[model samples]
Target chain A: MTAPLLEARGLRVTRIGDAGPLKVLDGADFTLERGEVVDVLGPSGSGKTTLLRALAWMLPDAEGELWLDGSAAAEIGARVWRTRVALAPQRTALFPGTVADNLLAPWRLKVRHDAAGPDSGALRRALDSVGLDDVALDRDAAKLSVGQAARVALVRVGLTRPDVLLLDEPDASLDGDSAAQVASAVARFAETGAVVRVRHQRPDGTATRRERLVAGRIHGVGDCE
Target chain B: MSEAAGVVTIEWPQLLLAAGFMVVVGVISLRLALGLERDLALATARTYVQLFVLGLVLRWMFGIDSPWLVLAILVLMVAAAARTIVRRAPDAPKGMLGSSFVSMALTGFIVTFAVTGLVVQVEPWYRAQYVVPIAGMVLGNSMNGIALALERTFADLDARADELLALVALGASPWEAAAPSVRTALTAALIPTINSMAAAGVVFIPGMMTGQILAGADPMKASAYQIVVMLMVSAATALGSVLAVLLTYHRRFSASGVFIERGLRDDIATARAEE
Candidate 1:
């Protein structure tokens, strides 16, 4: 019984709304194993984004027991936890620079200061893997279309080399072919690490299991239909 | 009311002429229904009352010339300035009084000290006239800088929430995620000071220089004092903006490096409810 790559126990997020405290996520228990792609399906406002944000420790108001590699998340710290468990949020946020700069952004962070950024060759390959081989490395990222920026964001997070990647509606802006390429890229990611993606589409034939969020809790939806 | 050295003296009665100028403005506002009559009247009243009170306080303090009293007055001025910043910057996160106070106090004390001691070489260093007035100028400018910086920081952070979170998701520290907002805020806050320095003599004579000249001082010496005052104001504004931003930017995040969207609003409410 090897430990799960990433696990959340009794996770709860109580956000303050105009009315008052709104429990966005309550007692969410989840597990991610290596070499597996899990598709998290939920309603439009069923805390899907909140789950991924909570996993990445983006919500300071959130409370939970998170375990990574059999160690408590408290011991690993949020910065380290985020490095190991990256979340590419729903909105494709690209910095105001060339694509190369956006991809190299993770290494530029103080937490990753000691690590060297990927060379141009590695960056080209990462983009190639995400079907962005046509996008020039020196091209301005802000000029990229929504679909291109989304793929670039995926590559950027992927370049961080996390043990688990959480994608929040990553394919929402993507076309059919581009979405397929993204699925393949994520599948390649699952060959060594793991992925938890929130998408409206079906599993894309890569997700090994499917789970849907219901009223702030995770419930198994059997296997991919 | 006595004239000295070619300077025309304006007695208390002469200020009625100045009031008449406001009356002309108020009459226009009333005729056009601009509805500024009340504000004009209140501002006119406050100008007279506030300056009169300040004159009385300065006379008494200068007469006393006690170092303790000087220190106490400076502290009170800084405290009031800090409170004004906290109140003016509506978007600032809670618990900002300490940072505002510390930033204003440090800038006010250090700049005034340098001007009076090293630059002007006032004998007793803490001479109430030199120290108090210089400190008031420094604190007033720095307070505006700090308040503007704080307001800009919070607004930028809220506007760039997604961008900030993206950085955080990429393993950035709180400071790293907030660097852009801080830079933007500091630049915005320092623009007025920069412009004032650039326009000090060519565009207009600064108030200090005008006052010195009107008081029968040599123009060359007045220019020297005005130059020092200009440089001192710029320094105070820059230092105050930096300290205020640095001390308070982390309030946007948690100890675990998470970016709080509402900036401790929930935590504050929870604490209050618990109490």
Candidate 2:
């Protein structure tokens, strides 16, 4: 049997409070199989985003056991693990350069040295997947509108082609049409047996499995269809 | 006793006249209700007592011909400077005191020795008169530079954590993610030294040059010494600030190329505690 793409057991996160340690995610357990879209629904101040970040290994203080692609996350090096599991944060932060530079920024990393730069055709396709035209690639990424920046961020992360994508409120800044485009783009990206976990206020009907988070714990899970 | 060849002594009456001028300034502050009268009085008293004690200490240090004693004093100065920097820059990270101490000690000793031993050719190479003052100048300036660099780099990284994490998510190394903030901090830390270098002769006379002139040194020779001192100071400040920032920047991120949010939060907590 093939192992799940990502699995977490007894994960917990805490922040230092004036009184004591404040628990953010308490014993949050989850599993994601290939070709699955998991939507974690919660209102504001819930632990939806924190859970996603913990799964991405972005929270150093997080405590739990995480397995990625049948290997213990602790056994896998962080740089390699991150390449397989990427987190596209809620707020889109663009570098101080053109969209082409922002999109190609990942290729400049040492880990991607063996991989060649994405061709123009691939770049155009990635942008087109997110409702952005080829012309958007040359514009200044920093000057893009909030919605445009969010889409650019999505495209940028999508081009990395990770096995699992953890998106935190990807549609929070997007309009209805753009949100639809993002949903479809995510679906296309996940069609290759990759797992996509999204944190949203409400399920967008694209998720195969829906989980509700309340006060730092998962309450229930059900099929979205 | 008559004034020595290179010594200019201030008589008691002259010192009293200076004290009277300070009293006049205090009175003026009080009359104007600037709310500085108490601070002015306390500061004047502290300055008087500290300088008097420093004079005695310097005299004792100069009387001793041992290089070990001079080294001991220099170590003490570096430790004091490091503590001052840590206190001044409350936003500095956890290990900042150690980093600042090492940076200041290394840069301060190198530059001071270069000036006293090579440039000025002081007789014993560790003469308290020359080495002590030069080392003090280098340590003091480099301390400020290191503090500024550490504080600015940490604060900037914390503020732009999202930008940094984005790079990390793209498989960039921790160094690559933090390069922008480090560059900004280094530039900021060196600006004061650069400005001082630019305005050295044109803007105003520096304290060291003025002291040499008042102590009966030739004006041209004093100006030359001042130039060398300024160069050493500029070099030390740059080196110290860069070293401190590089050492402290890595602590802002974990080994996994993730920004240590707790590190930034701890820095804020430390700043509040200091306040």
Candidate 3:
């Protein structure tokens, strides 16, 4: 059998505060296989976002053994590992430029030197897949509405073609219709053998697996569809 | 008057006139409710005592013709300057003080030595008069640059944590992720030096030029010295600011290229604890 695309064992995250250190994630274990969509449901402040960030290797202090493509996380160079396992954060973080500029940003990174950016046609198709029109490429990214910016971020990450995508509330700002469009886009991406993990308020009806996070631990693990 | 001889002499009576002017300013400040009288008095006292001690020390330095003494004094100045810089960025990571000291010392020594030994070619290379004053100017200005750069870099990183992490998630190395903030900090640190250089001739006569002229040097020669001093200062500021940012930027990230938010939080916490 093929190895899981991403795996984490005994993952723990701590956040130091003025009051003292807070244990945000407690020995959370997870695994993602190709073409699987895992939905993590949690209430506010339940360390859902923290779990996503820790899996992306963006957390400052985390204790766990993580493997990507069967290689130890520590052995994989950070840039190389992140290029294959991308995280779209909760807040829409776009540069001060046109949407096209933001879309082209990941290509400018040194780790992407071996890979060329999508052509104009491919860019337009990626935008359309996320319910965005081609006109968004030229529009100022800063002027985009929160929902539009979130879609742009999703599309941008999709353009990178990462093997594992960790999305934190990718539809938090969207309306029902727009949220469905984003879910469909994610579903299409997952069809191409990419593993996806999303932190969401409720199931979007696309997840194959569902887990609820409560007080820094995963409480339930079951099949969704 | 001989060119080497001092042209202006200030006797006790003349000095008293300057003190009277300060008192007048203090009285006006009181009338305006500026609440500067106490601070003014304290500053005036500090200026008097510090300059008086400095004058005696300079006299002794002039009498001693040892290069080691000059080196020792410069080292001491760099140490004090590094301490001041570190104090400015209380939120910086641990070992920032040591890193800043090395940066300031390296930049300070390079620029001061270049000016005194190479440009001015002062006999004995480390003449107390030339090396002392030049090193003072270099260390003092470079200290300000390093402090401003460090403070700005840390604050910017903290404020833009999300943006920085987003860049990292996009496959950026820690250095690449911090490029914008580092550029901003370096620019902020160098603006003062750049502005001073631009305004030196038109806005005002700088202290070094005025001092040279009052000491009976030719005005054109004094201007030349001032120009060189300004250039050296700008170079030192640029070097120090860049070094400071480069040295401290890596501390913001982990070996796995993750931005260490906890490290920064811990640093700020430690600073607060100390305070």
TM-score of every candidate? 0.95, 0.92, 0.94
Question: Over the stretch B1-275, how does candidate 1's per-residue lDDT look in tens digits?
Answer: 12257576779789999999999999999999999999999999999999999999999988998999999999999999999999988877789999999999998898999999999999887798789888888888999999999999999988888887788999988888899999999999999999999998999999988987887778888899999988998899999999999999998787787677764566546844765
* Residue B3 miss distance in model 2 (angstroms): 9.9
Docking class of 2: medium
Q: What tens-digit string does per-residue lDDT give for candidate 2 at A1-225?
A: 998899999888765557765677889888888888888877766778789878888776677889988999979878877878998988799998998898888888888889887887898888887777744678987789899888888888888888999888889888887888888888887787554555654567778888888766786578877
User: Is 1 or 2 the stronger prediction by TM-score?
Assistant: 1
Selected candidate, larger DockQ, 1 vs 2: 1
- Worst 10 contiguous positions by lDDT, candidate 3 chain B: B262-271
Q: Candidate 1 falls in which docking quality class?
A: medium
Clashing pairs in 1: none
Task: Report lDDT (CA) for all predictions.
Answer: 0.89, 0.83, 0.84
lDDT at residue B158 of model 2 (Cα atoms): 80
Off by over 4 Å in 3: A16-21, A194-200, B1-6, B262-264, B267-275
TM-score of 2: 0.92
**lDDT of the structure predicted as candidate 1:** 0.89
The weakest ten consecutive residues by lDDT in model 3 chain A span A192-201
